[model samples]
Target: MTPLISPRARPLAAALLCGALAFGALATSAQAAFNPPIRMSHGIEYMSGGIGSDEAKLMETVLPRWPASFEFAIKDHQGADFAADVHVTVRDGRGVALLDNVVAGGPFMVARLEPGSYQVEATLRGQTLKQPLQVVFGTPTKATFLWPAGTDMAAAGTRAVQ
Candidate 1:
């Protein structure tokens, strides 16, 4: 049997294969690291995540376009730390519940909501915090919910709130 590939082409073929495999791996990892899963509930679209540096950067860039955005944290003398496993609820001005018990997967959340008044309730570790929001067209409404200093947020580590 005769060799199909010339000896001179073997090295170039191997290099090209290796480069293609490396590029595939890099693209896959970059996409996973940067894209947080967007979810839908009760006709509303939302996303929650800001755990790592890359995801946080992605969230910051995308958040402004959302009608509603929320941040969960623990603030105290030691400083502030991001929080997770937060349950959130949203209600319209009439007090009809739109979202109930929607747990956030990370420290930040963004939502696409109609322009109106809303009441948001975020619960963390048995404590619930409530904030009223006014979501308007062309303006983003932001809310931050903070727990007391003693809360254990070891999963998030410690970082200054940006």
Candidate 2:
């Protein structure tokens, strides 16, 4: 019959409950964001992943720390969709391959490279896109490779025809 919480303390209790709920939400999101593990190849370190919304958010958060970042997508009438299983190759100015691998985890990748001129080649559905890039100190070199639509590699089960 009697109120358990005094009128003077009701606002404080409500505020505490709200704060606790907010903190719980924040903890859940922090746990949801999956930060891909950093890998090393030939002394260069890199990480690749952006498969889900939370992972993508985590990727964006660390974009500024890497010297080079690459994003993969496929263009369509509605815009583009993130792509995976892209074969990416990074070459130095002398045409020596530094990082040659396939992105099987996700579509976004960040790499630590010395500031210099480089060549990036990304292949999807047997179609390759090449771009020249210059990585500089104190700046992150960003590149996005977008393939044309209709090249649904998985659905086609073979190389996409021109």
Candidate 3:
């Protein structure tokens, strides 16, 4: 019996299959790294959301099931979600950094930190809002970091005004 593929085409086909498999592996890993639950040091796990209407809707659905912990919501003084170009840093009372990362595409970030005092610093639109909060066991702690009113999202690289 003769092989269906010509000998000359075997290497090319093999290479394409390997490339596709490699790409699929990388995509799966990257997706796992970002979505559903983001883990941090000291037993802190977080979820990011509200970057779009669809995602916001999904978040609302899961809002009730969110772990009882510290919740950080970013918005502007005008009550608009500050969901663009954001940086978040959470430090414990002893100044130990617990969470330090950029908010890729969300207005809300939830972290289950150990019950204690923490400082949450959120930066957006070239402005920073630092908040002091405490998390208690069995109680939900929420903190909203707000940007100054009339803050220019475009100027902060948060959005491009057309």
Candidate 4:
């Protein structure tokens, strides 16, 4: 013989279970709707210099600023037998850094940023290169940068280059 739940308690238990299930579903849906506001991508290439020698390396960074998050991609296009490291920095019009790091093996980087204008810069080794970017609130913006081959210690910086 097994004990059974009382008629009065059975309805209460059912109601509570139903409420819990509904709450869980709502929470899951809310999480799925979240998004970022910034996106970025990068690429690299090596160019020949004088005397058939590797001169400068070309590094490219692509940025796509979304309404909720920032996304980006990076690539390296260098000649044979040469590779370069790439770093990226993003700042607001007031020279505030939003994102900065070295990208090695990734298709893109995304971040959440406030609505406004921004500047993006990319660097290779230590030298400073030019890769300006702009971001707008409630909209999307894209930017790209190019670096020459044989660029050792290439460093890049961006600050409200409006």
TM-score of each: 0.78, 0.74, 0.60, 0.39
Q: Is 3 or 4 the stronger prediction by lDDT? A: 3
* Weakest lDDT window of 10 consecutive positions for candidate 2: 153-162
Instruction: Give candidate 3's error at residue 111 in angstroms.
Output: 0.6
lDDT of 4 at 69: 24
Query: Candidate 1 on 1-162: residue-level lDDT in tens?
Result: 877888999999999999999999998997777988889888899999887778888888888989999999988887788888889999999998787789888888999999999999999888899999999899999999999877655645335685
Candidate 2 per-residue lDDT over residues 1-162, each given as its tens digit: 889999999999999999999999998777656867888777889898877677777888888899999987777776667777778889999998888764536678899999999999998878999999899999999999888887653521122111
Q: Write the per-residue lDDT of candidate 4 for residues 66-138, one digit (tens) a residue.
A: 3322222222463212222445566768886655554422212334556666676655556555545554665
Model 2 root mean square deviation, Cα atoms: 6.9
By lDDT, is 1 or 4 better? 1
Best model per lDDT: 1
List lDDT for all candidates, in order.
Answer: 0.87, 0.80, 0.62, 0.41
Clashing pairs in 1: none
Q: What is the C-alpha RMSD of each candidate to the true structure, in Å?
A: 5.0, 6.9, 8.6, 13.6
**Judged by TM-score, which candidate is best?**
1
Query: Residue 108 in model 3: shift from native, Å?
Result: 0.9
